[model samples]
Target chain A: MTTQQLYEQIQQKQSFLCIGLDTDMNRIPEHLLQTEDPIFEFNKAIIDATHDLAVSYKPNTAFYEAHGLKGWHSLEKTINYLNQKHPEVFTIADAKRGDIGNTSAMYAKAFLQDMSFDSVTVAPYMGKDSVSPFLAVKNKFTILLALTSNEGAFDFQTQQVGNEELYKKVIKTSQTWESSENLMYVVGATKAEFFKEIREITPHSFLLVPGVGAQGGSLQDVCKYGMNDKVGLLVNSSRGIIYASQGEDFAPAARAAAQKLQQQMAKLLHV
Target chain B: MTTQQLYEQIQQKQSFLCIGLDTDMNRIPEHLLQTEDPIFEFNKAIIDATHDLAVSYKPNTAFYEAHGLKGWHSLEKTINYLNQKHPEVFTIADAKRGDIGNTSAMYAKAFLQDMSFDSVTVAPYMGKDSVSPFLAVKNKFTILLALTSNEGAFDFQTQQVGNEELYKKVIKTSQTWESSENLMYVVGATKAEFFKEIREITPHSFLLVPGVGAQGGSLQDVCKYGMNDKVGLLVNSSRGIIYASQGEDFAPAARAAAQKLQQQMAKLLHV
Candidate 1:
């Protein structure tokens, strides 16, 4: 939703942990597969298990999409469940959708209106028109890709053309767009060292920090440089949480993982 | 499909036209809307009407995604129809998907493997890990967003830091990545002047060119500077082709629009 709303949740819960629901079909417990909609069942259990501990549930759309129509249905059901069960928990459709102006508007409508996700991750490569449509929707924030966590991120994202890195330029230029107030950015937790510089460019914008946990990013290091006065960080851990176990204890183990992160987030926010 | 296969088809048809199936619910004929799945019905009609005129059919995923589960089903049906009825026609899932390595791999599977689309549109902002995953798939190409046609495309794409534009740098650097041979690029037709420069960077790769009609891009200019020895252009016309008529004659009108582009393409090819 809005940064103000997210800030309140972080303050109230004393947590900024956004549990990632990157659910893999083969990785999910075998028992759940017997259900009519296994992915939805798994997501529901994870949401139910870890909702209170997590300020947000970031469902990377790619995971659900791998299963085809069933995957999309699971995504819809998960979002609907979140709205019905845990209204306070911010929902981020980690879709990374960006296109032409008219298309982006329809995309904004699909995730924000039709599916009812609080936010959708967007790519800034197509520039202002691709990203602006998402921001135009009231209460829906556009989490633009700034600095990602993948190793290949260094390939183009960190390339120096003249003086500044490309990612920095993207952030600075994006700030000039209409409804820039609603824009957040995706700054990977693995690139925690860049947080200080990233903050300089986007001081107030909430950072959707992915690539922690299974991706070997240190939470302590991320919090050290990424945290703002408003607890402006949504450190996401996907596989490390959801795939904690291969048995029926999977959901509970997921809850434990999320709880551990939430406890750490609480301590981080204490300062 | 590979560039060679795509090239052979273009040669066979003597056309560079790639009819875009941007089928919208509101725009579909009223009679088709009465069907259980209007999107599939509309796509089937258009495909039936214009299969011979076009070498490729690029379905902008947003149109299907807007309708939710039914939309996705329609997409699957349309792709299946293309495979069964017109196997020679190249199929593209115009789903601009890019993410981290693992996530991107799944997205590749979703479109290229599971869904059986030949190629997908991807954003290059996330760099190599994001794109390489899509390229890794056999018989599938990753069409990276290079220079787009939209108004906001200039916002970051054309922004100069020191010497080269960001998009130019992206094109220059991405050539070194793994399986780059499978990479195509999106160069909007509206940016016709930049075609020569783009050709210098990516000479052999196929270009999925959008903005041919409704976006006010000139087909003549696109062919002049953008065409290569390989006839390497998949010039897309979405609204101009699909929404040619809102009435029951929509399918036949779509064929007519496709024929007009095919005629121009044939003349450009000197066929």
Candidate 2:
């Protein structure tokens, strides 16, 4: 999907919300366990319930991968369901994958071309060749990890590379790579202040912000500093929305959780 | 597997040679495509032929992930085959995966506990939390990307963070994380000279060096500078060995390729 299309969806929905499908079998409703492929079932319900409110759905590969072959099967089913049922909603395979040149191309083919996700998260530690493969895929986005929400972000991300901090360098240097226009970024919502510095570097690129509800990152602060005129942000909320209830009304409960955020996002967009 | 056990395997085999199972359906022999699961069949043959010649086998996850469900199944079968048939040989999942704290735990479970790989490669861009989860796994290793072999490594890795270069800081900073003993470093063979500076930081930790044949890095230079008292290196060569012969003689050809590296390693060990 084009960035313009994503922007149109955000405008129409009045939300740039990217609901993360970080689904775990153990966390799903007890009744769902009796059914075949509980992960897929739960995701279907949530996506159905909140598809209107959310512009995108992100399934973190780690959650599915934890269950091995069964989990991977669920992931395949989930992505297929989204594309088949609701092609308008952007899909993200939140697989933080990167490798050397040819190896990275294999991942690009898997997620972008084969699996047909609108985007896949990539780590920039390996630099250009690792990331360029994803960018080369036409009409797809490669969300590079910049300032992650986790406590580990301080370990190296904020350190000085030269004149600028490492994350700033990441945002700046990536712009010069082949097919740099297709690039987006994963900037944690927890570091709201850093968004100002990041915006100065790449004003037009969309930022996938994780850490809104459970991770304690304020959505308002993220928008206040990070938002472009196009509302260039994909604020993700996974656990807080999906696991809102373990009861039979879990889907409705998930809608409620998402709706709450969407209302706030709508208000933010108007402001 | 423990560091001591890996060292024993290296000494017994007289090779720290890590043969990468970067199996691709398009690249394998024509006859193998006739089999039900061609990738597993190909990997089984290669492992059977080269088990004694190499101390370790690393299957890069990107190759498996490309084919989607079929590819993932191949990875499962390949890892299972290695654990069952070649139990003495150390296995590395060349899956450069790292995420937030809990998510990283899921991947660690998938590869280290569930998949039962001896070690899984992780990216350090997210900092300590992203990587430390892998280190927390009992009797398993977390091979962190220090200096990769690709042209992209020069982008951010070689840039000065403070007094030291970024990759050097990666090697140094990772040592302070919890359960750091379980950590290993990936210093590419292409940057053979950097190993001397890397060795000064953590002399004992094993360095999983890639880029020998296919990427053009010197084995003698790696052994001379990167080798510790315990012969701490698992130098990997994927295409150079696996795709050595895409004919009826593929397995034997792979063995021959592995044997050449093993012989070179043996002479390096004696020297």
Candidate 3:
């Protein structure tokens, strides 16, 4: 999906919400376990119910990977289902993958080309070579980790890199790389205040915000500081939205949680 | 495998050579494509040939992941083959994966528990929460990227965080995390001089040094500065060993390449 297409989806849906499919088999409804692929079943239902309310779906690959081959199979099925059912909705393989240049290209192929995700999250620690591979693929996106929401964010991301913070340097330096026009960033919504500084470096680039509902980040504060004319923010809510209920009505319950967020975003977008 | 066991392997083999199973389908011999699982077949041949010479096998996951589900299956088969055939040889999933606390735990499960890898490489960009979970796994290793072999390493890693470089701070701060005993550092052989400073921070921890032959780093230089009393270095040579020849004698050619490295390591070990 192109940036303009994603922007238009946000406008049309009145929500830049990216629902995270961090589906854990143990956490899903007990009844779903009887199915052939419980993870995919749960994701299909959730996507069915909430696809219209959200502009995108970001499946955190770690959850599926935990189950091994069966989990990977579920991931393949989930992605296939999404592409077939809702081509309009953007897909983000929230797999935090980065390596050497050649290896990074393989990851780019795995998520972006083979599985057909619109974007895949990448760590910027390896710098341009690691990130540039993802950006090299046409129409695909590379979401670079900036100020992540976790406590570990303070370890190195926020440290002074020269005169500026390390992540700001990441943002500024990454913009000069080949095909950096396709670059986006993963800025934790928990650090809503930091978004102002982030925007100073990447005023136009889209930011995938991941700490909204469960991680105790304010939507208002994130919007106030992070929003651009293009609504350059994808506020992701995973556990808060997907695991809204553990019963048979899990899908509908998820829809309610997503709908609430969508309503809030509608007000923010004045749609 | 525990650090003690790893040390014993190094002593017994008189080589810390890590054969990188970066098995690309296109790069392998054309005849291998006739096999049911070409990637696994190639890896099995390489492993069978070089198992004695190398102390460890680091399968760069991106190579397998490029082929999608079939590629992932090859990874599973390759790891399983290693665990079954060469139980003593250390297995490192060179996946370079890291995420949030919960997600990191899932990745830990995927690589360590599910696949039974002795270790998995992780990028340190996300900090403590991302890395700590990997450390939580018993008898498993978290090889953190301190200074990579790529040109992009200078992008953020060499930049000063305070008085020290960012990679130095990564080495220093990571040592303070919980279960830091299980940690190892990935200080590239390409930056052999930097290993002196890295050792000053992590004196005893094993360092997985890539970029030995194919990427142009001298083993003698790395061993001179990086080796501890335990010979604390797993020098990886991927293309130089694995793709030594693309013809029918590829496996034997790979064995010869690994043997050459092993002999050098043996001389270094005074074995």
Q: What is the C-alpha DockQ of each candidate?
A: 0.74, 0.92, 0.90
Q: Give the lDDT ranking, best first.
A: 2, 3, 1
Per-candidate TM vs. native?
A: 0.97, 0.99, 0.99
lDDT, candidate 3, B188-248, per-residue tens = 8888898888888999999999999979999999999999988889999999999999999
lDDT of 2 by residue, B60-111 (tens): 9999999988889999999998998888988999999999989999999999
Q: Model 1 segments beyond 4 Å from truth?
A: none
Worst 10-residue lDDT window for candidate 2 chain A reads A161-170
Model 3 ranges off by over 4 Å: none
Cα-based RMSD of candidate 3: 1.0
Clashes of 1: 0
lDDT of 2 by residue, A1-271 (tens): 9999999999999999999999988899999999998999999999999999999999999999999889989999999999999999999999999998889999999999988999999999999999988999999999999999999899899999889899989989999988998999999998899999899999999999999999999999999999999999999999999999999999999999999999999999988
Superior candidate under lDDT, 1 versus 3: 3
Docking verdict class for candidate 1: medium
- What lDDT is reached at residue B254 by model 2? 92
Residue A48 displacement (Å), model 3: 0.6
Q: Judged by DockQ cut-offs, is candidate 3 incorrect, acceptable, medium or high? A: high
lDDT of each: 0.87, 0.93, 0.92
TM-score of chain A, cand. 2: 0.99
